[model samples]
Target: MKILTNLFSVIASILLSASIAAAALDPVSINLRSDEKNPASPVMGDHLQFWSTITNTGTSPIEGLVAWISLVEIDPGNEQPVDLEDWSAHKAVTGASLKPGETLRTDWPMRLIKGGDYRVVVSVTDRGGRQVYTGPTIQFHVRQKPVLQAGRVLPVAAGIPLLFIGLIIFNNTRRRHGNGRL
Candidate 1:
């Protein structure tokens, strides 16, 4: 009975120490935002810029941190596991140590390849692989460009030549009827 009690006490102490260590490492906060005003719907073939901000909120400085941005496609109807390797772009490594209360901002620029539903995920991890902070997922849709129809194109193309012809006729008539100076 005494041995059992000692074993339970040791387990509790280890769990408590782990919780304290995790609390001490909770010093970094990450936020992600896009430069596009309407990130929910971006036009296909347009360049999109995403910004990630890493702030050290604790008193101790953090070292050897790395940041990355990933793009994942979502199926609106079914449950599918997001494959991180699907389409990922942009990775930045903080070469210098981050001071307490300091912020580091990184930009990831990617061109829209096709029209579909997608999400961007941004994350920051410490060098020791003990701490990881991930920002909220940004859900967005890429829309195809509007098609130009003949109903819209024909009128503009025909109107310009008719205006030029009318202008030429008016100019010739004015020259013939009025004096050269007038």
Candidate 2:
């Protein structure tokens, strides 16, 4: 009987702790900025640069700060809210701790080769490793570099012929008018 009672107590304690953990965690902010205004679409490079900011909104400043920001490939164009934890390679955060209600921004230097779609996830833990807060992920895009492309030129490649043809046609029509034709 005592054993049963003790087991029930332990279970109850676990449940209570879980509830507290759940309560501790709330929504926070994760911001991402890119170097290139038009980052490579199908990004082609050894590494792409990124700047990220991780903020905490909980009542107390979080400690033992460890986070991950992943870049997952997204559909090329349309805007989407990406899940930061989805399909990420697992990159750790830089700072060690964050004070309650304070926003600590991390530089978040990353190396990305492909450029389709990507996002950033900011998660934090307390000193005892209790998950205190987790923020939603933000998505972005990367484009392929133009210089390495075999024949990826601007409008000039398709424009020159059209311009010449138009000019020739105009001049020919003018000549007919200048000659004795109506």
On lDDT, the leading prediction is: 1
Give the TM-score comparing model 2 with the true structure, all chains together: 0.44
- Write candidate 2's Cα lDDT for 1-182 as tens digits: 99999999999999999987865566345566655743445365544455566676556666667766654455756546444332333467644766656776665545545446666555555556554455556565666565644366546777898899999999999998899765
lDDT of 2: 0.61
Cα lDDT tens digits, model 1, 1-100, are: 9999999999999999998787556788778888865455678767788888888888877888788776776856743444433233554556557889
